[model samples]
Target: DASAMDKKQKQFDKLINEWKQKCEDITVELEASQKESRHYSTELFKLKTQYEESHEQIEALRKENKNLAEEIKV
Candidate 1:
């Protein structure tokens, strides 16, 4: 009975260690994914700002072109 109990205890310990390692690995992966998400989010924000600025510049240029055309007709 004692030997059987000892074997069971060893098996339990092995399982516990394996579970702990799995938890650590999952935590590491979660952190890496979060970091990647933040990087992409920042890039997206920068691109959106750049697009807005470019759109404004294009609109301004169009207005200027129309005025120049009208002046030439006059």
Candidate 2:
């Protein structure tokens, strides 16, 4: 009876250890994913800013070209 109990205890301990290792691995993956998400968010913000600036420049150029055309007609 004593040997059987010892064997069962060892099995339980092994299972606990395996679960702990899996939990640690999952935690590591989650951290890496979070970091990548932050990086992508930062890049997206920068691209949005650049797009807005380009749009403003294009509008300004169009207005300038219209003014020039009117001057030539006169």
Candidate 3:
């Protein structure tokens, strides 16, 4: 009976060790993904700002063209 109990305890310990190892792996992977996402977000913000600036410049050019047309009519 004592040997059977020891064997059962060893199996339980092995399972617990495997579970802990898997949890550590998952935590590491999550941290890596979070870091990559943050980097992408920063790049997206910069690109968005550049797009907005270019759009404003285009609007200004259009207005200038309209003013020139009016001058020609007058």
lDDT of 1 by residue, 3-71 (tens): 999999999999999999999999999999999999999999999999999999999999999999999
| Highest TM-score model number | 1
- Per-residue lDDT of candidate 2, residues 1-74 (tens digit): 99999999999999999999999999999999999999999999999999999999999999999999999999
TM-score for each candidate, following the candidate numbering? 0.95, 0.92, 0.87
- In order, the Cα lDDT scores of the candidates are 1.00, 1.00, 1.00
Per-residue lDDT for 55 in model 3? 100
What lDDT is reached at residue 35 by model 2? 100
Error of 3 at 43 (Å): 1.2
Ranking the candidates on TM-score from highest down gives 1, 2, 3
Clash totals in order = 0, 0, 0
Give residue 8's lDDT in candidate 2 (0 to 100): 100
Candidate 2 global CA lDDT score: 1.00
Each model's RMSD to truth, in Å?
0.7, 0.9, 1.2
Error of 1 at 11 (Å): 0.7
